[model samples]
Target: MDSANIVVVSGLLIGLVYGSVGLLSGFCLLSSLRGFWAEGDGRLVRSYALAIGVAVAMTQLLAAGGFVDIGKSIYLQSSFSAPVMFFGGLLFGYGMVLSNGCGSRALVLLGRGNLRSFVVVVVLAIFAQMTLKGLIAPSRIAMVGASQTTTTANSVPALLAGAGLSATAARMLAASIISAALIIFAFAHQAFRRSPGQIAAGLVIGLLVAAGWFASGYLGADDFNPVPVTSLTFIAPIADALQYVMLSTGSTLNFGIVTVFGVFAGSLATALLTGRFQLEGFQSPRHMLRSGGGAALMGAGGVMAFGCSIGQGLTGFSTLALASLIAFAGILVGTAAGLRGALRVRPLAAA
Candidate 1:
């Protein structure tokens, strides 16, 4: 009934929608890129592009309508460490390929009874916590402190406003240009257009991101107990969820933690109802080693970057923050390294 409760409920519902859609549509950035580059299938990537486009448009609209103060979100911080964020994205991107999925994807797979994903989720959470508040925290803090820079313009819209455009005009112009570009790219592919399922996935997922902003920013705007404004992100939340499981007495429930649980539950229910639940595990010790290492990288990198793929790629990007752009670029480069060129991770031999 209260603002906090509204946010909690919204998080759960958002997670449920995301999980269900993810399971049904196989919506994942890594999978999309891999399919495009390796298999020459552009449908998945197009879906991702469309999602980003829609998210940017809708999120900006909310900000323009005074429904959300997106400037308060982490992505738009005036001071940021570009080097650290970029490098973190690189690590996360590479780790994603090695692990065969990102955090959200791992959660979905875990719900489908993939024991390998179970390992990935646990290890990723542990390392994410480590990077966030444990042994790795000091080093991460040092790196950020050393390289951080402050700027008047932290987002594309802000930059445009600085260049003589009115604030409102700047926001609309920047959002329109970027969103239109991505949408055009997405729809240019006839194959993607033909896949109504992927189109729906993109639209729904993008809308859910805006829904997240509305939930935390508007609905949860309490005078005395204001909630932190956030959208769909998995890295720190997964870590926090793990911590909550162990320290329930001392810990408090937040949107991120609840969203993690909701994602698992939604995916689990979907898997069972769709007859897709199947037990699976690593083929060998080597496989386990690779998966664990990748998860660790993702955890650490995601923290340094301040988000995972869905976190930065979609949610952060939706704000048009310059830092998100840098991180997203780093992720793309890292993914490319893992998927192609000399640094590409070769597939393991069949056990």
Candidate 2:
């Protein structure tokens, strides 16, 4: 097949896989964090950690095997604003808490018949578009430009190479160490391995990340016209999907938007078949307001950080970019702030 056809077909196939895996396993970062924090249930949280570990290992292996170039990913640009990415993560983390979920989680919940998620997704999409090439784009660009940092080694591989190691060796060493450690930690809990849903969530999510690389980097590869290589980032794509719905005439569907739609459709079908669909609503007006406000922060923050929890936490980290690390740190801090202590937000009481 020609490159364009390859890109389109690969994209669709990738979306299908993502939708299936996410629906079947209920993969989500916000849920994972909340479950652990509020209830002391760490299964989902560990599942997410397993996915991240697998992504890092597999992606590094791909780079070493010469199957894909990690540097080509957007997270590894020569210049990136540390402050922007950092603060962006903080905003996204905090927003996810208030919204009761992140963008991707909202999609999954919407599939399961949560109308509240519909509002969260809509507001997130609108604000994300505003941040990306929208009214807020100018200010964003200015801030990024002001705080951008130039670096000789944009990614971990490059850093290793600078330390007198070959690229291949660096990749192998990094992948081996990181992946092995994660697998050890995950499997150490025999009870965790016995939980099919959590295990499936980890494995399938990891595979989805790898599949994204195959779709965008390998299949989408074209000498003349190239599509930007990205995986499952939810913030901007939520906005882009909204725009595509309205301006179908001018806008072309991208990998992220297609995947987002596919997840909802797939999850909806699954929920129906499994009798999991239950129409749920907000407890109060305050709940609605907080959720909307959270969605707005997620949209803007995801744009600035260049990814959401899944975007930067999984896909960006998969690239092993220095920027991704900074973004992840920001995410942790923001999540902590929203979950506890001074930054903790009160839950909306039922009206």
Candidate 3:
């Protein structure tokens, strides 16, 4: 296939995998954190950790092998707005708790016949667009623009280089140290090793991260008319997908938007075939209102944060970008606050 076809096909396939995996594994950061906090379960949390580690190792390896350049991804941009990313992550984390799932996870749950997630996804997509280029985009743009901080050492390699290491040596050292730590944490538990589905979720998700890089870096690479290199981020795509639906005449379909659609379609297909499809709705008006509110927060926060859990958690983190780390930390804190009732509002547990 030609480069354009390659990008489209690759995006579709990636979305299919995400949908299938999400359907089967119930993979999601919101659920994982909830399970850990509310149910005293660490399996899903470890699974998520494994995914992050694998993403880091494989993505770094891909860069080291010259198969792709991690620097090309958005995470490593010279413009660094740490506060925006941090607050964005915080919003996404807290929103996920209120919604009871993150964006990608919501898609997966919807496939399993959860109508609640359907509302969440729709809200997320719509608000995400608003955050990206919709009516509220101006405020977001101004916020980020005013807070943006330019930095040469955006990536791990650059940071290491600043510490007096050569470029190649810095890259290798950073990769080894981080990967080793992640691997040890992920594999140290016998419980983790025993759960094949959870482990597979982590592994497959991580591979998909690398796959995104390869797709953009290799398959989508076109000197004549190259697209910006990116991976499986969800926030902006949720918005972009909505825009594409209305403006396909004047706009181009990007990998993120296409992949977002593909995941939903793939999940719907799977749900239908597996006899799991069911029409579901809210139990009360209160629930519907909460779902909508949660989705709005997701969209707005996701835009500020530059991604959702899957977007920043996997794709952004894969690049070993410093901003991704900040975002991740913020997500953790926000999730904790929401789950623990630390926020002014009722916590997830109380709700």
Tens-digit lDDT string for candidate 1 (116-200): 9999999999999999889999999999999999999999999999999999999999999999999999999999999999999
Candidate 3: worst-modelled 10 consecutive residues by lDDT: 342-351
Candidate 2 residue lDDT tens string, 1-351: 766567666666666666656767767787787777988877778888899888988787776777776678889899999999999999999998898778887888788899999999999998888899889899999999999989989888788889999878877777777778877777777777888888878987887888888777777788797877777778877887888888899677778778888778877877898898999998888888999999999999999999999999999988889999899889878988898898798866558
* 2 versus 3: better TM-score goes to: 2
How do the candidates rank by TM-score, highest first? 1, 2, 3
**Cα lDDT listed for each candidate:** 0.95, 0.84, 0.82
Q: After superposition, which runs of candidate 3 have C-alpha atoms over 4 Å from their true positions?
A: 344-351
Winner by lDDT: 1
RMSD of each: 0.7, 1.6, 2.2
On TM-score, the stronger of 1 and 3 is 1
Query: Which TM-score value belongs to model 3?
Result: 0.94
